[model samples]
Target: MHKSIAIIYNQPAASPYRDRNEQSAEDGVLVEVAAVEKALHFLGYLTSKIPLALPLEQAFSELSLITADIVFNLFEGFSGFPETEALIVEQLEALKLRYTGSPAAALKLALDKAETKTVLKQEGILTPAFQLLDNATLSDFKLNFPCIVKPNAEDASHSLNVKSVVYDYDALKDMVSEISGMYGKKALVEEYIDGREFNMTIMGNNILTTLPISEICFSLPQDT
Candidate 1:
């Protein structure tokens, strides 16, 4: 019998940024859902699309009703609530359903930049020193100048922009305040690494294989 799959995802909405020319950050989820649905169809598996949203119990009920053998688990979270991304996986686990991607605990850890850095440090991995700051404790930040500030629990550069990098204490405070106020979360202030950057994609659980590394080159100025 052919296996069935559910292409779950967080549906894309209008771009929150003022620049209308830019696409929505959630667009990738839709793209992945479409691509996966098509590929599974070609492979002779029945597929269904499940767009996750508010009233998650309703979504969960729908998921349970679906006869799919497994879920692709592309749901990233409802709009403006990136921190809830892991909850979707948690629900899947409760349902005793098979799904793809990282587990809920891993998802939660990866979402919190400060906690992730702490774990990495404990493992003897070289990670930049960082501090988690909120409006109540902004005055306590003592990191070196030229630090990068970002939403503590958000992914996909939710509130990150050119202004995320700060050169002075005032700029750092302002950026941290902006992140906390806008994203409604603590800000992660980390020492900025002034050097080339690269992205390496690792796959597989038992035997991890690193894909080709791609160097990140910014066309804009260094301070931008």
Candidate 2:
């Protein structure tokens, strides 16, 4: 018998503050949803796509009604509500539903980049030196120039642009202030390293499978 699978994802919220970059990021999830649905069909599983949005009660109520053997959680969550991603997973757990993707604990931990970096540093894993600035105070700035500033808890490169990368204190201050003012959160300033970017995807829980290393090719200017 083919088992049913529920594919849950966050319905992108439209906001005046969301620019082209943010919209682009949110839109990519639609592509991901289609790809996952196709893959599940090929695997001979009954599939359903559930798009969840604001008003947490409605989302949770919808979740309680799911009748699937497994859930493929593709929820990247909505802006300003980063905790929603983990909360959905937690709900699944409470209902004792089998689901794909990381657990709520891991999702919560990974959402905070500063905390993730601190964990990596404690584990002796080499990571770029970063400072978490809550109020744009550079009085204790110790990192060298050529740094990138990002919202402490945001994903999908939201609010990131050409100006995100800075080479001077003035630019750094501006970027930090922007992140704080826009996201109402701390800014993460990390030492920038100019080079190609790569992603290593690993899947599974009990037995993990590491996929091929994927490199990100940039066609834009070096500064960008």
Candidate 3:
């Protein structure tokens, strides 16, 4: 039951590098912002929309002038700048603004696949061994054959499909190259975790509230 300034993010509209062969898609939607704004409106928040596709200084400067009482921080990114997700949250904190959901540091750790792995290791969570393959770093990496390749910072199965599995040196090179080039992000290739995947949702702040555990299943594998 309070007014707030909400920051929201979604992929900016862009035509895929047009080729005569590329068909179009229905324009994407900003579901997160829409749903949050709807809920806040019901709760008496005078919500104002902030469409960000530029630098943080622009948002920060404008927020400095806005009269919103609290910030409902939903900004997942600032347009083309995905790395600045947590940085913007830090800006909000420095500006003495309160927002919703997880903090900036948590967002950054989860957003980055590599850093998350390091933290998992620190917490004694068993994870597949991983190697970061930039143009310069992987010379000594002794990856076993039949490794999996994917873009480092990408989530949502982007650039990951049947072809993402590699069985030889050349296959690894090609998969890494394709993911890095096409996704515009670093590639994170690791030993494929050949196990059942589980989805769990953790809710509530102080008290523990959990939804029933969910299992993720896939079609049976084909013999190579």
Residue 20, model 1: lDDT of: 26
Q: Which of 1 and 2 is ahead in TM-score?
A: 2
* 19-101: candidate 1 lDDT, tens digit per residue: 42324667767777778888889999988888866777777777677568998888887666666688888888888888888
Model 2, TM vs. native: 0.93
TM-score ranking from best to worst?
A: 2, 1, 3
Write out the backbone clash pairs for model 1. Answer: none
Q: TM-score, each model? A: 0.87, 0.93, 0.74
Report the candidate with higher lDDT, 2 versus 3: 2
Cα-based RMSD of the predictions, in order? 3.3, 2.4, 5.0
lDDT of 3 by residue, 1-224 (tens): 55565554533545332231221211233676788788878877788876655556776776566467777665555433456778777777787776666778887788789889999999999888888785455565587767899777644444567878888877887787777777666678787767788999886678878899999877776873
> Which candidate leads the pack in lDDT?
2
Q: Please give the distance, in angstroms, between residue 4's alpha carbon in candidate 1 and its true position after superposition.
A: 1.1
Query: After superposition, which runs of candidate 3 have C-alpha atoms over 4 Å from their true positions?
Result: 1-7, 15-29, 135-139, 181-186, 195-208, 211-224
| Candidate 2 backbone clash number | 0
Query: Which scores higher on lDDT, 1 or 2?
Result: 2
Model 2 whole-model lDDT (C-alpha atoms): 0.86
